[model samples]
Target: MSTTGAPPRPGPRPQGPQDAGYGYDVERLDPRGPGRMGAAGPQRRRRRRPWARWALFGLSFLALAGGAVLLYVFVILPLGFGTSLVAFTAALLPVAIVLGAVWWVDRYTPQPRVSLIYAFIWGAVGSVALTFVIGTPFTAWISPSEPDQVTAQFLGAAIQAPVVEETMKSAGLIGLLIWGRRYIAGPIDGVVYAALIAGGFAFTENILYFGNSFHQAQAAGEVAGFWQTFFLRGVLSPFAHASFTALCGLGLGIAAERRSLMLYFGLGVGGLSLGMILHALWNGSSFFLPVDPANPLGGFLRYYLTVQVPIFLILVAIVLFLRWRERRILRRQLAEYGRAGWFAPAEVDMLVKLGARRKAEKWASRHGAVARMGMRDLIRATVELGMERHSVLHGKPSERTRRRERELLERITTDRRLIGALTAPVVRR
Candidate 1:
C-alpha cells in the first residue's frame, strides 16, 4: 500500500531573490540574471515620469495665485484700518506654537519635509481659497433680505461653514493618500499631516478674521474688538481646525495600512463626517447657549470649561493611544525581521525602545557628526524595512515594495559600515 506518511522531506526549495541574504551581494540572486537590476529596474523608470514635474508646477502656480488673492483681501484691503502688523503677528504666533507641538510629537519617525510643507500649503491656500469661493455665494443665496442675526449666524456656523471648510481641508489629506501613500505609516502620521494642514488653514483664516475685526473696531471707535477676537481665535481655539481635521487624518492613516477597498472608503467617509459634525457642534454652541455679551470673558470661561476642554482632553487621549500603537508596531515587526536575519536580535531591542534608541544616538555622537548621522540613518532604514515587511504581509506587496526593501537593506549596510569606520579610529586611540 502507498504510505500516507509525509513524503521524505523534499530537497530544500531553491532560494529566490527575496530569500537571498540581507547583504549587498544578494543582487546576484536577481531572477533577471546577474547583470540586470531586477525589481528595482521598473521603479527607477517610474520615478522619472514627466507628468510628475508638471503636476508639481501646476500646484505651485495655484498656491501662488490663491495667496495673491488672500493677500489682497486680508492685508492690502485692511491697510486703512491700521492693524496689519498686529493681525499678522497674532496669526503667526499660534501657528508657531502648533508647529512646535507637531514637530515634537513626530520626533520618532518624521514624515518627509516636502510632504509636510505641501500639506500646509494646501490647507492655507488651496482649501481656504476654495472654501471662500463656494461659501460666499452659498451663504449669500441662503440669507433672507431682512435677516435675523441669530438665525443667520446659527445657519452659517452650524451648517454652512463646517460642511464647506471640513470638505476643503480634507482634500489635502485625500491627495496625500493618493500620491504619497508610502509616507503615512500609521495614525500618528495622519495626525501630523492633518495638524500641519489645520495650522495653515488657521493661519490664513485668522489673518482674515483679525483683519476684519480690526476694520470693524476702527469703524466703531473701539480697540477692544481686535483683542477680543485675538483672545478667542488665537489663544483659545487655535487648534480647533487641527482637532477637527485630525479625525479625518486618523481615518486616512488607518485606511492606508489596510487592503480592503470597502474599509478604506468607509473610514475615509466616516472620518470626514465626524470632523464636520464636531465642527458644527463647536460652532453651534455659541448660538444655542448664548454667552452674555456684557460678561464676554465669564461666558467664554463657562463655555470652554463645559465644551471645548472636554473635547480637547478626548483628542489628547486619542493621540496617546496612537503613539502607544506606533511603539507596538515597531516592536512586533522588528522582532519578526530579527528572526528572518535582517536584523540582529539585540539591534531590534535597541531600535524598539525609545530610551535605547536615544542612548545609541548619544554613543554615536561621541564618534562624530558623520557617525551620529550614520547611526540615525541606520535606525530609520531598519525601522522602515520592518514597516514595509509588515505592510506587505498585511496587504498586497508591489514592485515598489520590493525595490524599497532592497534599498532599505542597502542603506542599513552602508550606514552601519560608516558608523563602524568612524568609531574604529576612536576605539584604537
Candidate 2:
C-alpha cells in the first residue's frame, strides 16, 4: 500500500457527473484536478467508560454558553446593550434558527462543536473588544468634531464597520481553518463556522441597536424609528452575517483543498477582504437617499436585498447539492473496492447510505453486542478503504485526514484477518 493508507499503484479514481454504479469503470473515467476528494477515517470507537465523552461534551457546551454571555454583558453590552431591543431580538432569533438547522443536519459527521463556539466568541470578542482598542480612539476623535450628521454616520457605518467589523468577526474562522484543519472538511464546513461568528456579531450589535431604538422611540413617544431599524436591519437583509462570513469560508475551503501556491494565502486574505467590502457597502448605502422612495433607483435596500438575496439562496442551494452529489460519487467508487478482496460487500453496502447502515447494525445486534460493535467497525473501515482506493486511482495529493488512512487500513486488515481466523467458511464442493 502507498503511504497514508491508500494503494499507491492504483492511482486516483476521480468522481465525475454520474449516478452510483456506473460500474467499476467510474475510476477509469475520473478527471484529475487540484481539488481531490481525499478520504477520511470515521472516528474510531474507544471502549472506555461512556461517561468520559459525555463529560467532555458538557464542559465544551458550558464553555461556549458562559463565554458568549460574559463577553456580551461586560464588553459588548456596556458599549451598546441599551441600543435596540426589538431589532436585537429579531436579528438574534433567525441566527439561532440557522445554527440549530446546521447542527441538526450534520448529525452523521461529528462536527467540531468547540470550533464553532470559538468562532462565535471570536466575532463578539474581536468586534467589540478589539474595536475598543483600535476603534474607540478613532470614534472619540471623529464623533466630537462631527455634528452626528449623515456624513459622520456614513463614515462610521460604511468605512469603519465593514472594514473593522468583518475583519474582526472573520478572524476566528481564518484562525481555525489554519490551525484546526483536521476538523474542517471544505467550504460548507467553513460556512457553518463563519456564519456562527457572524451571528454572534449580529447578536451583540442588535443589543445596541435595540436598546437605542427603544429609548429613541420612548423619547419621541413614537415607534417609527423602531420599525424602521427593524425593517432595515432585519427584513431588508437578514443574511448580512451569512454574506460577510461566507467569503471567509470560501477562501478557507479553497485554501484547505487546493494545491496552488498563491491560492492558499490568496483565498484567505482575498475572501476576508471581500467580506469586509460587502459589509462596508451595506453600511455605506443609505436607505433614504435624495431620490423618491417610489423611484426605481431610490434605495439600495430594494436592489441589494431584493435582487441579491434570492441569488445568494440559490447559490447556497447549488453548493449543498454538489456536496450531496459528491457523496453519491464516493458511494459508487467505494462499492468497487468491495470487490477487491479488501472488504466485504455487505460492509460496503452499509456505508452506501446512512439508513442502510442502521438497518445492518440492527441485524448484527441479533448475534450479540460484540457483533454489533464489530459490524459498526466493519462499516467504517469499508467506507474509509473505498476513499483511500479512490485517491489512489485519481492520483490526488495527500490531505490532513488522508495521512491517517494507513492506520485505518491496518485496522481494517486486522479485522479481516480476525474474520478469517475466527470463523470457518463451509466448503461448497
Candidate 3:
C-alpha cells in the first residue's frame, strides 16, 4: 500500500512486450511513469448531467415511497394490534443474521455502502411491488375451479411464483451490474449484493406470510401456526432467496469483465434460468407429498431434509470456493502492484491475510480510535486498489480506471500518514 514513508524502488521495466508476463502490458503498468501508457497529467473531471441527477433522485424517492406503502399493506393493514410487532420482530432476526453472514464473507474488499443500500431497497420495494403488479393478474387467470383449489395452489406455487418472483428479484442484481459496475469486482461481490437483495425481499415476504399465518391461527383457536411458519421461513430457510439469486449474481458478475456480447448474454440468461429452476423446485416440493395437520410440520420437515438441506450445503460449498478465489485474486493482483512499486512486499503480505489485517487494526487501536479507523480505511483502499489493477490487466483499461487508480493511491497515502502520525509516539515509546 502507498504510504507517507519513502516509496518502494521500482523494478527494472521489462525490456520488451514479450517480457511482460504479469498479464498486464509492461508499458501501461504505471499511470505516472514517462512511457507510452503513462498519463501526461490528471484527466479533467466531468460534471454530472442534470437529467442523470434527477433520474437518480426520482428512483430514490420511488423506492422509499413504495417501501412505506408495502410495509403498511403487508404488515400493518393485515395484522392489527400486536401481531405486526411480533411478525416484524421475528422476521428481522434472520434478516440481520443473513446480512451479517454476507457482509463477513466480503472481508477481502467491501463494496460501496450506497450500492449495497440501493440493491436492498430495489429488492425489498421495487421488486416486490412489480411482482405484486404482474403476478396478481397472472395467478388469477390460472386460478383453479372450485373442485380443484389444491391444483391451482400447486400451480401458483410451482410455476407462477418462481417465474415472477425470481425474475423480479434477479432484476435488481441486473440493474446493479448495469449501473454500478464498479461495485461488483468478482463472484464474491455478486454473492454479497445478491444475498442482501434476497434478504430484503425475504424479510418483506415473511412479514406477509407470518402475519397471515398468525391471523389464521388466532381465528382457528390455535397459536402454533405462527411459530411453525416462523421456524420454517426464518430459522430453517432464511437463505432461500439468497441462494437462488446468487446464481444470477454469479453470472452477471462474470459478465461484467467479458468483452464478448454473446458470452455475456449467455451467462446472464443461464444464471436467471438456473435461479428460476431452483426456486421452482423449492416451491414445488409441497406437491410431492401430503401434509397431515396433526403432524403440522411433517411435510415441511421431509422437504427440508430431502431438498433444502442439500441445496443449502451446495450453496455453502460454492460460497467457500468463491471466497478462496477472491483471496487468491487479491494476493495475485497486489503482488503485481508490489513488484511495480505501488506497494511494498510486506504490505502485500499484510493485506492478503485477514489475520495480519486484524492484528494491524488491534495495534492501531492502542494508539487511539482515530488510528484504528484510519488503519481500516487504509486496508480497504489497498484492497480496492488491487481490484482496480486486476480489472485493468484482465479487462480493457480505460481513462476512468486510470483516474480511479490515482485516487486510490492518494487515499492510501493520506490514510497511512494519518495513522502513522497518530501512532508515532506509541511506537517510539
Best by TM-score: 3
**Superposition-based RMSD of candidate 2 using all C-alpha atoms, in angstroms:** 10.2
Q: Rank the candidates by TM-score, best first.
A: 3, 1, 2
Q: Residue 280 in candidate 2 has what lDDT? A: 72
| lDDT (tens digit, per residue) of candidate 2 on 190-226 | 6667777777777667666766776788789998877
Q: Encode model 3's per-residue lDDT on 206-288: one tens digit a residue.
A: 88788788888889999887788888899988899999888888877776655345756898788889988999988888777
Greater TM-score among 2 and 3 belongs to: 3
Candidate 1 runs further than 4 Å off: 1-77, 80-82, 140-149, 365-368, 426-429
TM-scores, all models, native as reference: 0.81, 0.65, 0.83
Candidate 1: TM-score? Answer: 0.81
- RMSD to truth, every model: 8.4, 10.2, 7.6
Candidate 3: TM-score?
0.83
Q: What 10-residue stretch in candidate 1 is worst by lDDT?
A: 18-27
**Selected candidate, larger lDDT, 2 vs 3:** 3
Instruction: Return whichever of 1 and 3 wins on TM-score.
Output: 3
lDDT of 1 at 312: 89
